[model samples]
Target chain A: MARLSPEVTALDTMPNSAATPGPTTLGEPTIDWDLSIRPVRELNQFLHDLAHNARPEMPHVRILHPNGRHNLAVGLQVPANIEILGHAGYFIAGMNQAAHITVDGNVGWSVAENMMSGIVRVKGCASECAGASAHGGLLVIEGDASSRCGISLKGGQIVVGGSVGHLSAFMAQAGTMVVCGDAGAALGDSLYEAVIYVRGSIHSLGADAREEPMQTDDLKTVADLLQRAAISADPQTFRRVASARQLYHWHAEAQY
Target chain B: MCGIVGLLVKKPELRRELGAWVSPMLDCMGSRGPDSAGLAVFAEAPSTDLLRYSLYDILAQDVWPTVLERWNANVDAAATLAAHGQQATLFSTTPSALGKDWLSNYFPHLHCFSVGHVIDLYKDIGHPRELIKKYRFAELAGTHAVGHTRMATESAVSPAHAHPFTSGEDFCLVHNGSLSNPHSIRRKLERRGIRFETDNDTEAACRFLEWRMSEGDSLEAAIHRGFAELDGFYTLLIGTATELVLVRDAFACKPAVAAETDDYVAISSEFQSLAHLPGIQQARVFEPAPEQIYRWHV
Candidate 1:
């Protein structure tokens, strides 16, 4: 409630309360929300209130024509199955607890930022800072992610099917990032315990981050993540990137 | 934050729809920026000896007709003008520099923001929707258009300070990010006798890149040079007589998504603006990469 509402203007976010439940097509409870006329806040508000409702079996929520709007499906605490039909905007599926969200198209900045649990998937590309500072969750981007992706990561797992731009995973504390494509400049700068697995070429590595020989557990991690994301990639081609731990303490006297 | 949008139509039939499509695109981005808005349209150039100048005086109330009458009497008797809101498009056989000097010397309040064979400019301080309505942007016909919705983070909110800053003929640029070293760059350009119209930071970048093109570098080469000279976070969308070019800084934190169909190429800071475009469902949608220049010709 403290952040922007995105509903006050009533410009593109007009309410379409005339949305009706389906005629039982999928065997599970199904509901449709058309974002071309329906407000994004109403969808998020419904998702927020789903935890308090009495129905233990959640309906499948499908969003159509998101139009790159900001703050969609935010702050979900229920275990509902949500699917976005088209491109959504920034901070979509942010702060999730136990829901499974799927985006069939590209997303804007900060997709699934600060998630505590559950899964978030992007079938297309993503903008900057994907899965940033999440306590726990499984996030997937099937295409290239822009710069500063996964910066300051807490304990999230990010799997990218395409390359990541420059300065990805900067100052990451913990978690794992498996990039199926090449990494752009300054990958894993000032890194800590978080590990990175890149299958393609690396532009460069940041301060104190170096490539280590892959262990058996790293292959298992990559394989498990790619399987969960439903992407096909060879685990043997990936290289491990982690912290060198040199900047943990500073030397009092050093040459400039 | 600022919102920048660009559209270039490939098919001749889509030219008339430029204003109608771009107006809603700029209006929807009001969430990111709201203080002011501006638009620069590049129509098919007239095969005449005349040069076109887009002039503005936001403080004046219905002064375009009077300005046109005086220009005909004092500057050029053959000068023809089309007055719209507080803005006007003047067509004359004189050199553009002569037209600019006349505006500066005689009518100091009237600022010529654009001078070209194919470009027409309009900008104001208000909601983007109001600017769109006042200027009758929906009826405009153009080969391409570039627009900006600004929050006035660095300079004053005025018609001059609004975005879509123009430089050498038929060239305009709209920026979505800030520059850390605009003053230093301004000083460097000023040393070369580059006269600036405003102290806004984006003007420095526009003038710098346009200067590079003036020095015989191609647009792509100038942008590569800009990568070395300009220091900041920026996603610049430049429109020329025949092309619309887009580039993001090294980090590319400022977002921009583009959707290209057979009929048109549409770009916005975010995708919401382009959601309603024709055949957008079948368009090849993608995000512009870092430091890469993407150019689509009309």
Candidate 2:
């Protein structure tokens, strides 16, 4: 339950701290293309180590990989800007915080699960549960988030620029979920406390959920989140759904 | 742990009878939580001063008036109106209540109060339809409600260990997922004289919300606070008399989906369950933002 620093670092001027002596741009943290690189795994390991030890003053970094590999930038928590030039598998930057991680290409499942703080932007479409059980951070999926994005979340914001698969937010405890497109079924089922804002027609509202009229306060909140997510929509156009407080007790007959 | 459903109409022009609309929606989600079922209705009472409480579980075939009198004396509740606009009666039965005839029997108590009906709780050892039929539940109704189907991960199976659990007056919660830091939070709450009935993580959530509400925070704000304090994977839905909220874990471990139509709003474990809902004009659905919250009001 460590709190992340609220200071935000820009995406340039990062340091290079790879284990291997690889080529690096002078002063700037971008990858040095001059050196003939080693195995993809070795290069990924070097880059991961570099990212973990990157200087705080340096704000930006870019890794250029010609081949698609597995487990790139695993456990990257450095407060710097990072970019991967090629595709990756499994967890890339899983549990990232502070660093603004950008994938130049596609990614595998669970891209940024358990992200405590900061932004993880996926440039391409992601696999299932892209940000599963993350806490206190912003995950921006440029494409669709597969099933269970932002499930069982404690806090933070996930803005999917596109649509999502089914059972998203299945057991979400608290956080704001904003889908620019349509959501799959059973959204917010057995939810404890959170707000869901959708701009399109809902397939169905789960049990204990009801449609609520938009008010000034609600509009303001939605507008703020849209601004942060870089989504453009009239706040008035969004419809909100939440639980109706009916099933709060078990009677003698209902007692099993 | 349980399934809950109900409807809320903001305008006086909206139809007052809620059973026809909310019942089907509740039944549709019966699979999410089957255990047991019960319904309660609340509205602008005819006599504003008379605080009428409808109790569902009482000694079977026993004198209800006597029980009510004793409960009133214990809690200092007085019978203000002998006969009023609509009689508020309590209905309860063992097993699950599902059939059409059994459901209709509960209609006698659902006069004017039948408007804002809420099947606030149900908990048992089986699926939703089985519990519904076993207990004769089609008669239940409500406008705003929340429910749950328990997988029984952290808590045991019992009526007390159900969703739509309450912590105080006007606060209810239904949760999916587990709470890792319940003991620390629970100890703090207990020190403040907050009593807890169940050992499940959902009650911890309810207590968290109640504490926030008691501290002068709105239900939505209290839920927001929970996002920071509560750890582990969880998808939570909270229901209050005036508002509804949904929160997703920061990692997005569980699943939840929602659809809003002009006439009806539906949420289910899968999108297929929402297929039967009518008049779907335009749907904009998405998952909750990791570690974020969504809230709406009536």
Candidate 3:
């Protein structure tokens, strides 16, 4: 954790040492935007203006004093590295594209909803509907997530390091959800092509959901996802969940 | 939405600063619930025979003298009283039930918000700023405290509807989230001869737990039964004289995070509320699991 001195101001340049170490950060400059003195709308306005501005390179921005306020960085398109210091509220990093955003604290409801691309990481737990109807990107939660984690997920990959509440991955169409910890009731209800991997107990499975044997390729995929999400777990210990395909085509034999 | 916060000091030296630390924790959740706010603080018990009851909505000063006169006439022991704005705290050597009976039988309009040896409650129908201005929360000192800011979801915004609802002696509960089947549960409790003060679902839940505890069940047992019977989303912070218990519903629609250190155990609706506490950076912070009761004793 990076500790900023109280006297440090926005004009005082601080290196982004708190972000997760990655290979891409070779020589890029990291900018710090402290939200304690400034309003939340400033960050949103900066991100919005960044889309039209012709900058030579993508900026790495660090945010402070998240204080559980809603809509911190809602619609960002630039491929910037953004890190929030404390808890944030709803719709954080929503509709993100080609950016890497990390929250150091818990997030409120509907985090990363309808995200198109990029990586959104939460170091703490998230409230309901974590990644609803997302197309692409990898959303990682290091802590528990509440109900409807991946509701109506389209093609995004979500990895939860801790347990998830009920109705997770409900009506998920595409992509995969990996839970290193337990999952609540109705793990995947009305699921489609998306796959779910759980290492811990599942209270109950939802409609048209069943456990499938993990193949070699599935293990590799789980391992890859865990590595990308920066979670440590035994890939072989996970059980795969997918659609039973029983409700794919209507049949008179499948009577009510 | 509603915000609930609880702080239980484990170290004796930090007891005096409990209220100062908790005031900011409650204020941080101002956006979650802007309608009304309340808090219950538990300090050292004054005496074994002395029972303290905090009352609200007393319009005139004569009401207290009349009640004290009537109470002294009925009971052999005399009572002492103090007033702060519309609220009053009365201390009597009589049994708690006797004091309650006197209030109910004589002063039907006055609301006894809390009745216990160590618990003193302060609440009002206003924002957190107004609550702070009316009741200097930082001036209070105690061992443990529970605070709530309610965002009128189930009932109207009023002082009586404010949270930290009390049913048992030295016990109060603040809740975040509405119950799906509170009316049905209220009916069952009403049949058991339990009286209710508000139409709030959290009060219904509090009364139900009180009834369960009265029926020879422990607090943990009563909470487990609540998990099985209660419907809808909730994250409840229940405070006793010496304990603070945190319980979340099965679905956990409401947010609750708990942080514990060697000096204190704190719970809030969000981590930001606990961020400013002393030594909170190194405290163990995590969200309580759904349907699991976590208790910390003083």
Best prediction by TM-score: 1
Can you give the DockQ of every candidate in the order shown?
A: 0.76, 0.02, 0.39
Name model 2 segments beyond 4 Å from true.
A1-143, A146-256, B1-65, B72-77, B80-126, B130-141, B281-283
Model number with the top lDDT: 1
- Give the CA lDDT, 0 to 100, for residue B16 in model 2: 46
Candidates' TM-scores?
0.94, 0.47, 0.90
Relative to the unseen true structure, what is the C-alpha lDDT of residue B290 in candidate 3, on a scale of 0 to 100? 78
Q: Mind giving the per-residue lDDT tens digits that candidate 3 earns over B1-298?
A: 8899999988887888988999988887777888899999999756576778898864645577666677777764468888777788888877777677778877987889999889999888888767876788888888899999989977888888999999969999999998988999899999988888889898889998989999999999999889888898899999998899999987787888888899999999877778788887678877687788898988
Top DockQ hit? 1
Model 3, docking class: acceptable
Show the lowest summed lDDT stretch of 10 residues, model 2 chain B: B108-117
Candidate 2 lDDT over residue span A1-256, tens digit each: 1111121211223323332333333464444211124454554455456555546465455555422344556566667667776444457677777767888655556777888887788776565677777777887777777766666766767777777666666666677777777876666665556667777766666555567887898799888877876778788877776655444554565321
Candidate 3: give the clashing pairs: none
Order of models, best lDDT first: 1, 3, 2
Q: Can you tell me the CAPRI class of model 1?
A: medium
Clashes of 3: 0
The Cα error of candidate 1 at residue A4, in Å, is 26
